[model samples]
Target: MLAFLVAGVILGVLARVLHHEPDDPSPVLTVVLGAVAAAAAGGVMNLFLGDDLTALTPWSFTSSCIVTFVLLGLLEGVWWRRP
Candidate 1:
């Protein structure tokens, strides 16, 4: 929903700041991708650990951040790794 989308953008931007990426993903695309990434994360968590999300709140956003970082981090490591 709108809340998820908005929070996704904020989370994405924060992740970008944390990683110091130079405009890797546009803000809007980052948000949209983040939303999908979040859903994938939640599904993976539930399927593997039986964790279920029954509510969306501050905790949801925090979870989104964690999920986004993990997903993006892997992508970054694979494609953007520095030696």
Candidate 2:
């Protein structure tokens, strides 16, 4: 859980930096959403793998990253479509 939160924060910051645009919402919101997505993904992965919340595995980490990025992309799309 701790590792996931840390990784999620890092990924969230990365997403904010890499995909940010002038019309987008607050950077802090983007990062928060990314972290939430990552943590949720990590928790789901751990549940499936029968591991503890803090368990750190390659697959779990990879899934967390992937889910976070995907959610960030979706968020960007939604923001883009807004008038």
Record all residue pairs in model 2 with backbone atoms less than 3 Å apart, i.e. clashing. none
Q: lDDT for each of the candidates?
A: 0.59, 0.82
- lDDT (tens digit, per residue) of candidate 1 on 20-78: 66636555655566677775555555445544543445555466568877766665445
Which residue runs does candidate 1 get wrong by more than 4 Å?
21-29, 39-63
Question: TM-score of the candidate numbered 1?
Answer: 0.49
Off by over 4 Å in 2: none
The lDDT, on a scale of 0 to 1, for candidate 1 is 0.59
Candidate 2: C-alpha lDDT? 0.82
Error of 1 at 18 (Å): 2.2
| Per-residue accuracy of model 2 over 3-76 as CA lDDT, tens digit each | 77777788878877887678876788878887888888988998899998768888888899899888888887
* Count of clashes, each model: 0, 0
